[model samples]
Target: MARTPSAMKYHRQSEKRRLDNRARKSTIRTFTKKALAAADSGDVDAAAKYQKVVQGLVDRAAKGSTLHKNTAARRKARLAKRINAAKASQGSA
Candidate 1:
């Protein structure tokens, strides 16, 4: 229901940005899940690798304003904790 020309253009731009943000968020979730699965499976190396990728994605999302800074930091911290725990268990095993 964008009556004015400028408003119509703004709506289009907003839609594009919305789709892009959604895609980025989905990618973040996919990597996060992969990292968590690797950690749960006790693959320290793979978990660490995936965690690194997820961290980068999260940082990028936060920078782009797709995710809040604190949210990104919290996620990274949790991922690191899981990886560390997996590493400790691996060493003990």
Candidate 2:
């Protein structure tokens, strides 16, 4: 199939957006991992900080359509659950 000028332009735009979205998602994953590790290691302060950052990123991603709103909500909820559980254990320990 021959590439039309508009189709070629759209392909380039989509490629750039895909890369941007990938980077955003990667950052979210990295921060979420770090946050979970901190929580598990009983570093509550660090975990809280990381969670805050993750929440902000997730919210932005959702708003920008990089992620679905419900998916973002679920991710945030799960992270909060784990972080809170860690805190609870810390208290009992």
Candidate 3:
């Protein structure tokens, strides 16, 4: 489909980048789920640790342009809120 050499090279690069981005996105989702699970279990320490990992993943995704910075911030905020709520509930109980 690519007529020029540069176009062919770009097509190949695009395919590789797509695969890499998909992997990174899946990894980010996995970390997010881990954090949420920890929060659900009411494990404050584990939730905090997983939240840190999620934050790192979000930051990397935003930095790499795979995810928008605002979107990443929003996700981090939501996850942090959940973790904090779990911590508070555990403290009270």
How does each model score on TM-score? 0.94, 0.97, 0.94
Name every residue pair that clashes in candidate 2. none
RMSD for each model, in Å, please? Answer: 0.9, 1.0, 0.9
Sorted on TM-score, best first, the list reads: 2, 3, 1
lDDT of 1 by residue, 1-93 (tens): 999999999999999999999999999899989988998898888988999899999999999879999999999998899889989988999
- How do the residues 1-93 of candidate 3 rate in per-residue lDDT, one tens digit apiece? 999999999999999989988999999899889889989987789889988998998899899878999999999999999999998899899
* Candidate models: Cα lDDT each: 0.92, 0.97, 0.91
Model 2 over residues 1-93: C-alpha lDDT tens digits? 329999889889888999999999999999999999999999999999999999999999999979999999999999999999999999999
Candidate 1 ranges with C-alpha deviation above 4 Å: none
Query: Which has the greatest lDDT?
Result: 2
TM-score-wise, the better of 2 and 3 is 2
**Which scores greater on lDDT, model 1 or model 2?**
2
Q: What's the lDDT for residue 28 in model 1? A: 89
Superposed by TM-score, candidate 2 places the C-alpha of residue 35 at a distance from the truth, in angstroms, of 0.2
lDDT of 3 at 23: 95
Off by over 4 Å in 3: none
